[model samples]
Target: MKIEACAILAALLFHSLSVSAQQGETAAAAGFSKDIAPILTKKCVACHGPEKSKGRFRLDTFEFLMKGGESKSASVVPGQPAQSELFRRLTARDEDDRMPQKDDPLPAAQISLIEQWINAGAKFDGPDPKAPLVTLIPRAPHPEPPSSYHHPVPILALAFNPDGTELAAGGYHEITIWNPNEGTLLRRIKNVAQRTHSLDYSPDGALLAAAGGSPGQWGEVAVFNPTNGARVRVLGSMPDTALTVSFSPDGSRLAVGGADNSLRVYDVPAGKEQLVIQQHADWVMSIAWSGDGTRLASASRDRTARVYDAKTGDLETSYTGHQGPVFAVAFSGDGQRVYSAGRDKKIHVWDAKEGKEAGQIGGFDDDIFKLLVSGNWILSCSADKKIRQHSADKRELLRTLAGHNDWVYSLAVDGKSKRLASGSYDGEVRVWNLEDGQSLAAFIAAPGYPAAGETVRASTRE
Candidate 1:
């Protein structure tokens, strides 16, 4: 009986060892799309990806990653980590020789995972090895917003629907819609990026487009149904935040600008990419479509504003008078002139065809954040906590709407209601009677957060 028990125990032990070995093999087979791609995209791809390829090495795709660079050595050897130049640089001892030269070395766990993956034969698991790394990694669901806020979040973006019935304000990972007249919380649309920098409604008000993203990781243009708050579609997954989005006069086309230094245009109905203009050397901060939809004007951190043929993506002209980063841009009602403002603290109006400075609007105390051309009036918001109206043709200051305690980052106007809305960095959204410049309504945009002396119970009841 003792011999039989010993034999049985030995068989069970063998089975356990077999299962352990299988589990180890599975663990060593790190998925390229899931495990390895995220690490490279977050840490290494900024310097070696599509936007800027250092040493002519591009890790934007699996195919380009293995193609190597000027090193002449192979970037990857199917089953040999030591023989791979990419792995060698990652593990190099010399600081200058190490990959991601300026950043700290990759953590040990991540390095070990790469080593094990290579040893396990570095198989391509994604559907397309030629596709960009951003497409390969599955996006995790975004976290939910807090039920109530401890403090106010800066309102960087705001918009009023075409009818001016509801207002939308950017929040942390969400957009909050409110009654412009009553300052009542209507609803919140969730599942957005970390920050929303700009918002606009289509000409017909069928769709609302939001531009923003995580600062250094990725940017996108999120479209939604303003009525029901259902996401319509998403566009542009660039390397950095998409700072601005504008709809064409016909509402058939949408233009997007990004920190990726590229301007992308999309067909609203077909959802197809129309053109990609990359003339700017830095972040493209804002976009404005011409009245006739034939041209587009863009503001950039490159200290220049450029005009482009809307359909062909041809460069019409570039206005460089700002001498600093341009934050806002708009085309005149006639489509013959462009108005741009930024760190220069003045609105520069120029001839669109020749890029010549026509006139300037002075008296701004700080950098301007937005420029809106409504009828004959040009509305602008600035870091000086004021929104000023100027004549589009004469370039004369008309009225100053001042009340925001912090920088006014965005502005929206309603022609029918004769009301204007402005969002500030202090988390305040204010509505004004456009005719008299009188304050109509004001409230903190954060959901479930009490206003001034109001209690949390009172806020939640709404």
Candidate 2:
């Protein structure tokens, strides 16, 4: 979401957990309200609870068990006692001592009782998961009219502010800010200009810069106060509608990409054009700054992506392999890699400094629009209507999320939890808990918020 025409993203808190064994019915419930708490407390809690926390294992509650031991696998499934890992470890064939280490396993009758409880679906009632985690209900930035989906708006871009407090998005010349948790719009920074095209927040979160223009024509960029939405200064104008904008890591300068096949850099405080590079042979599709602010990567419609030295405005190198226009580009945290996705239906990983093609990513049937890198994972959205997670190094597809019904246009990452938010051409923004592909929020905007009953979700692949 963009605040005051500059891109500022709201920090989102994600909720989810990845489970195994295909999510069987009641594996975790192997011991129920009447059966399990006491068993664990009597046999396990002493060594595992807060005081000792032996093996970094704590089993005072179901959530603790769900967040099993250091091995990181499900210990007690809610259903399916047969596959419950705890059962296997306890009933080990070698009985030198299976459970309790020195003592024998729980008596046979007690074990049977536990099995029965698990089969019933581990219905937990001990306490709410957030009792210890004070959940802060975010103040609503966008008002809820009995329903937020009643009226929907076309969305184009989204970004989180440097400090992670605000979100900004543009498309209808309108920017909406959300608390990121309460799902409330903190403020709506309105822009009356023709479709707003680009947004970026200064490194300090005090200044915001937005760039856009009449479609097909050169555009303009503006700077504003992030907290008040007051206009600060005009960054300058573009030769064509801009595609993306970025603030240098130090927040000293702003870069803009345009349809005229060029990238321009602007000095922020002075509000003057610092350099213009006629690099891409076609419309520049995307641009990203390395973490250190020394380099910038650009993806373009010419089926190529290139690196530039930010200081000299000189061409560094061009990496090409896309069979189609490159739509998106991003630099890794350490600035070692550049990830680009495009119309060719593939993602190409390139070494930023050397501009060498590092690896090729495939598994989609359509163009890729946006790409973001986090640690060893690359999160991407595609024309395939899917947001996927992949191993940045191994070139392995990790998960393919199937919720969007239209082309995904933008993507954001939860810097802390590694979750994702995807906005699509379909007028819906879906938040996914990338850890398990959990669909936490379904934000749908239409001309008028539709009745709840009118909402429809695509059938998940069985």
Candidate 3:
């Protein structure tokens, strides 16, 4: 009886091992060009590519793969999938030392594909001109990210739909679309190649205008079809770095501001420069055209915010109240009131038509980098890392959102839903459900950010 039992056990073990090997065969049948190339493109190429050969490794070709890097050994041994150094790095947890060194770890399915490919002896017919490594084209370069919090991309600008159903976040190299309620990233707009600075959606939500590029180097102000991120119009280019952009309320015109200290207007579809409102004495850091598009308000390091006539290219008002450089400007819904903030550590509201001080709200201890006014409240974020919500009518401090450990530089408002979005200098963007004064979501730009002394230490309700 004992002999019979041993024979049965040995047969069962042999069958199981055969099944495992066959599973690997199925994956190998999918092949290197089809199954493995994608993993290399998304996860391996960044560190081991032509532009940056970190560790002296290049995974672009099978020859490069077999030659390995400075470690002086093949990263993958044919038929020994379990002993591959490439696989080890892929599974490593130390972000600074890990392969790819950008976002989250590769998916299990992707890692499995490599294991099966190696177990099949890592055989390849090499690159084929006719085949060209066809892959399932992802909808966009970044596609739908699994999580914004852990992504390597840092958010530079964000805007919301009028109905407040969607939030659009522009990143260093991509844009993250999210569900405001769930704070989940839905899609990424990846058409622009460089780190983006400022962006705004059209009134109807059909178009998006984005600006800012290589620091000190101005980039293209592109009008994109937000649904698919197809460039509808290369509206214009800034000869000098532009910091902010705004779409006219009617969507017929675009206003861009930057270091050239000019606010240039371009006719949207025609992509022609309509008029250059180059009157500011310092970098025009902010631009906002009133509801009728007749007046353009600009804030700058010139220690003042000016309102210009869109048609005549004339400065209509030099509204100055703050003692320091003004950094942000916004017009109220009706265009009757303007809010400007700056290093003065106070927000100055002005009568748009009269160009006189309407009210002054002060309390922030640092430069006020950005501001957004919604309903009856003015939400301001400053270098001190405090988000202050003030009574728009009374200009009184209602609440200070204190939690971030760094300076806040950008603000987005969902008018209908009362949601406030803030992007910070420390490389993080967060959404607040203003109804209850609670944070809805925060997307950290890059990992290892907020190094000592540079982070915002504001405290707010979660």
Candidate 4:
């Protein structure tokens, strides 16, 4: 009887071992590229992929996955699926502890495949063996200004010097400085960027900062001498396109917003990054520094605006009332209030000190692209091809300056001169007298480049 029992026990043990072996083989057959990469691209890449990295975690490549993130440990534990943070987060019961926050949890089958891959030693089979493991560097040369015969190029960004003597309009690889009073081009600051998205003058009017990049490739922020257009300092480059740049009240630092969904502050004199604030879930569209320069406000395509401590990079508050992508943000003269506008066709005002909604202005027929706060007025330009002026303290529509035949892309206000500059997609730049709501000067910025259609007559209303 004892011999028979021993044989049965041995047989049972052999059967168990065979099943375990089969399971291991199945796990080993799960390919990293074929099975695992797709799941990550679809489910994880939105937050951890290129353009943005939440929690400092990036899972776009096998190397990045192994390097881990802020936790500073391998997210995947080879041969130990149960112990892996990657698998654990996917299966976490608590929503807060889950891998993809605010998104639907991965289906069970997808989770199983990831677990199997990790259990099988997490080997990688890259798409190309010779491909570089890092993100591709931008190789495209900076664009040059179009020849005189070429069509008028759209102006996307505009700014005024503190003294209101000059206006800076962003062009392809150049910043065109104009005499706002004479309605003539002064000089072209050349070879700055391939596409300029934002421009700002230092508070003291000594420097002009240009922000832009080769979309989907790289981004740059360059400071230049406004007097001679000499390149002063190239702050640095980013992995994605930068859309907005603003100088601090004292001009000692700069705040930059970019497609990477981050707000970075750089020290001007030291030429080094001082702080990186990552909170927005989508592209950061605009950034504004307070009058005191202690607080910074940023708007994002994530449908929210946020205020951050400029010095510490800490998030002070977030304004979430905008229903669409927030594209423009500005702080009032005293830095006590914040204003933001976006695709939702509404302007939201917030108390900077309390982080509470103060007021809202809505009536635009299209997306508002840029905003300027001049004294008690809030001026905005829109895709509707018009520039609208509003009372800052009240929800009153002051006037609408309509002249652009295409989308209005940028706006700049010179309070000292009482002039408002508006740039449009058709390459027209119109300067308006705020006091009388009259078109003071009008000209085609890039003369021959009329964007999508033939050049229209400039509005020269007195």
Model 3 residue runs over 4 Å out of place are 1-154, 445-462
Per-prediction TM-score: 0.90, 0.63, 0.63, 0.71
| Runs of candidate 2 exceeding 4 Å displacement | 1-153, 163-165, 445-462
Question: In candidate 2, what are the lDDT values of residues 301-363, reduced to their tens digit?
Answer: 999999999999899988987888999999987888888989988888888878888888888
Ranking by TM-score: 1, 4, 2, 3
lDDT (0 to 1) per candidate: 0.87, 0.70, 0.73, 0.83
Error of 3 at 413 (Å): 0.8
lDDT by residue (tens digit), candidate 4, 427-450 = 788889999899888777773444
Single out the weakest 10-residue window by summed lDDT for candidate 3: 130-139
Give model 1's TM-score versus the native structure.
Answer: 0.90
Q: Stretches of candidate 4 above 4 Å error?
A: 1-48, 51-143, 447-454, 457-462
lDDT of 1 by residue, 1-462 (tens): 999999999999999999999857765768898888888888888989877898899887899988988878998897899999889999999999998788899998888878878878888889878866766777775678788887888788888888889898888888888999989999988878789998889988889889988898888787988888888888656677899988898999999999889999999888877898999999998999999999999999999999999989999999989978999999998998999999999999999999999989899888999999888889999988899988776778879997777878988889888888998876888899878889998888887777833421122211
TM-score of 4: 0.71
| Order of models, best lDDT first | 1, 4, 3, 2
